[model samples]
Target: MDKTTIICRCEEISYEEVEEVIEHGGRTFDDVKRLTRCGMGPCQAKICTGLVANIIHEHTALPLSEIPLQRMRMPLSPIKLEILATNSTAFSAVKSVLDEVEIEDGKVR
Candidate 1:
C-alpha cells in the first residue's frame, strides 16, 4: 500500500517537511510553526494545530497534554506583524490567562 501525505495547501508543504522539522528539535508548538510553517497560514493553526500536535506526539513519544500548546495571543488569530508590533500595548495583555485560571485536582478550574 502506498501512503500519501499533504501539508498546507497554500504553502504546498509535505508531511515529510513537517516530520523533518519535528525530527530536528522542533518540539514546541512555536518551534514547529517556525520550522515548517504548518500553522502560519490563513487558517492560523486552527486547522493544523491538532494535526501537528498529533504528529509531534507520534514522532517524539510525548503525550498529547505534555506537548506545549501553541501560545495564542489576544486575537486567537493571525494578524499583520506590523500591526501587532505597532500596537505594543495591545500585546501587553497576557498571551494567555494563567493566573485567574485554576487547575484543580488535575482538572481545569
Candidate 2:
C-alpha cells in the first residue's frame, strides 16, 4: 500500500503515520490514536477503528481480540444541538422536528 494513502480521513492521518506509530511500539488502536489522532473526529472511530486495527495486527502480529478498542467519550454518536438545547420530556422532541416540515410535489415546504 502507498504510504501516502490516507487511513483515517477524519483526522487526515496517513498510512505511513500509523505505520510509524506501530513501528515505535503502538500496539493498540488507542495507542495509534493518541500518537496520531487517527480516530478523534465526527465519526468517533466508527469508520477508522477497524482499519487501524488491521494495521496494528500486521505490525505486531497480534490477534484482533488482543487489540483493544479506542476509548470513547460522551455523545457516542452525533447529536443535534436542538436535542440537547431544549427540554422535551413532555413531548416527542425528535418527532416534533420532523413534523414541522411538510413535503409536497417532491419538495419540502
All-Cα superposition RMSD per candidate: 7.8, 14.1
Error of 1 at 95 (Å): 8.0
Clash counts for all predictions: 0, 0
Local lDDT at 5 for model 1: 71
Q: What is the lDDT of residue 12 in candidate 2?
A: 92
Decoy 1 TM-score against native: 0.62
Tell me how far the alpha carbon of residue 37 in candidate 1 is from the true structure, in angstroms, after superposition.
1.7
The whole-model lDDT of each prediction reads 0.72, 0.84
Q: 12-98, model 1: which lDDT tens digit per residue? A: 567778788887888877887787676777776777777777778888999998888887655577667678778577565645455
Candidate 2 collision pairs: none
Query: What is candidate 2's local distance difference test score?
Result: 0.84
TM-score for each predicted model, relative to the true structure:
0.62, 0.71
